[model samples]
Target: MNSHYSVAVIGGGQAGLSMSRLLRQRGVDHVVFERDRVGHEWRTRRWDSFCLVTPNWQCNLPGYAYQGDDPDGFMVGADVVDFLEKYAASFDPPLLEGVEVTRLRRTRAGVFALDTSAGRTTADQVVIATGPYHAPAVPRIAERLPAELVQVHSSQYRNSGQLPPGAVLVVGTGQSGCQIAEDLHLDGRQVHLAVGSAPRAARRYRGRDTLAWLDEMGHYARGIDEFGDADEVRLRANHYMTGRDGGRDIDLRAFARDGMRLYGHLRAISATRLDFAGDLAQSLDNADAVAEGIKDAIDRYIDSAGIVAPAEARYVPVWRPDSSPSVLDLAASGISAVVWATGFHRDHRWIEVPIFDGRGYPTHERGVTGCPGLYFLGLPWQWTWGSGRFAGVAQDAAYLSSRILDARRQRFTDEVSWLAGTPTETYPQVEWWAAA
Candidate 1:
């Protein structure tokens, strides 16, 4: 194995693969390290019925965009794995699988020292593309629940059959939670969903796919600085919806109409009971408002473009009782399972650097970190709203690769100057293009 490389990409997913492809194009020497097979999360973390929320057209890598017949259709988890595998195999990147990057730190001489499961290696540049979601983020209150009750995260859940027999309480209203609740409910399990402030979204709006419209409007490409509260926008909950069910709406209101019991946020868990916040109705209203705002934006776009389009019908609001208790006795309700879908936090514990902000997210100008020779990719709002998605990482990767190329050029210039007895100060210093 090569102990040294110009760049070391710390992942094997779309982000890392795309970065590697761009680096290779620039004639940059690099190696990709993965703890498991390529696209490990798609192979393991996702549920059995998992599918990409974005359509096939949005799944773009560096050299390979989705060329399948179903451009509008969503790819299932296994199909995604196949796509990634083919992408990696096609280029045959210098990928070292089953090699976990246990630790990464910058040496005194400014090179990255990576301690991996395979062996130690050094790189002049390092790109952390491990993605946003790392560990399951169940609340600490869950530990107070009874041991008999099966507690599974969305990552651990496969099918309804895997869960013990009884009613299930899914403690989230994000995309994953909504989809999982629908799956379990449709499978004949009594489902109770804990609604939160997750926004609702219409899968299609104004005679076009919502995602397509957003792309057309440059919504996805909006930089973080464009927002008033950048952190708030970055940390905003994903809208409640699903690409399954033929792109039908799957918000909290939809779930309630489907006979699924809805509750507020999971506040606490006692020995045999669960306490919820009394804000279900308010939460649903907030989600509906967001949905309306999105549709309004689409309508404005149609008008601004002078495109003739049919008016879309508005969704009817679902009603709930004004007075509902804020508590549930889990034992009395016969709830045997709790599926926590509270989302995930990026685990950068292995990194010993000061490039992180107060929230532990990497502080970067695009993918280039404040620390020279270190970078991050596939992070939420890393550059724009789409920074973390399949459609966006390629752009960020290309930008980062260009920066690396500039650095490589400078390195060569310095080496030649040193060998010729020329003063290093006489060498021309060229600045790389800054991300816009």
Candidate 2:
């Protein structure tokens, strides 16, 4: 083994592999550490019917693009895994599979020492591309639920086939939750979706891809640093409603068309029962209000941005359900399952770095971390829309690789003066972005 390389990538997924490929193109030596085989996470994702939300064309990884017949079409999970494996094989990304990184500590000499199950290794630079969706974020109220009621995180859910034959309660209004609800409804299961804030829906305006248009207009390219804090928050919040693909819109109308019931967020979960805040009429009204707000926001953004377009553009509401029902009351309606698609949380207890923020994400700029040579990629909204997604990781990897190369070049010039030393403090120093 090289013992030390210019860079050490701590993941083997699209992010890490892409970074490796970019580094290779730049003639930088690097090794990839993967807990299992390459693309293991994608291969093991909970949904059997899951397909890339971003089309195959967007799923490019470094030098190679998706060469299959369906460039614009979504690739199934297995196909995606296969593509990644092939990409790695073609590029010969230096990967150490089945090697779990147990500890990543910063040596007193400023280099990162990775302790893996196989052996220990050190590198001048480390890229933590372990990704954002580490663990599911189930609500605390779930523990109160009676064991008799089946509970499964969306990550563990494959399809309606795994669910019990009863009314299904989905506790989230995010993309995963909404999609799962739709799937269940299509499978002839009674689905009750517990929604929190309404998400921004992808509006197919005049048959154009909404996301493509946004990209062309440089929407995702602008980070929170470029836009003010308020705009960034609004953009982040709006993403919940808007589908990643601009063209294939997921609207309340679609959910309603599929006969899925939408309800207010679940307040409590008892044995085989759930409690919601608002009454049925009130819940419906709330959902409508949220949808209207999202629609208004989209219109405002388009108008302010001077996006001249026809008024006949289709607007998808964030939430749509004619009526709502209590979780307990749904039993009488024959609802029998609960799928929690409430998103994920990062678990960095094993990371052994003080670099994490309150949310457990490593504090880094681009890919540079507080500890010198320690980097991170594949983080949610790290840079832009494509930061953590499989399709977006290439851009992130390229940018990150450039930064690392620059840092590596400067390392010999001035240890303390270069890059102002390892950042002891986080950036955007505002209370919102700052670590709590």
lDDT of each: 0.85, 0.70
TM-score per candidate, in order?
0.94, 0.83
Report the CA-based lDDT of candidate 1 relative to the real structure: 0.85
Model 1 — which ten-residue stretch has the worst lDDT?
427-436
How many steric overlaps does candidate 1 have? Answer: 0
TM-score of 1: 0.94
Model 2: lDDT to the true structure: 0.70
The number of the candidate with the highest lDDT is 1
- Per-residue CA lDDT of model 2 for 1-436, tens digit only, reads 4556668888898888889999988998789889999878877764876676665677777888889885656777788888988999888988889988888887765677778887888777888889877889887877876567788999888988897777888887666776677667778887777766645444444334455555566766776456466334523533433233323555544576567666677877655567776654454445555555545655676788887766653343445444565556645666666788888777777777798766555777765788766778887677776777765678888888888888877764554453364452432212121222
TM-score of 2: 0.83
> Would you list the clashing residue pairs of candidate 1?
none
Evaluated with TM-score, which candidate comes out highest?
1
lDDT of 1 at 23: 86
Stretches of candidate 1 exceeding 4 Å from the true structure: 422-436
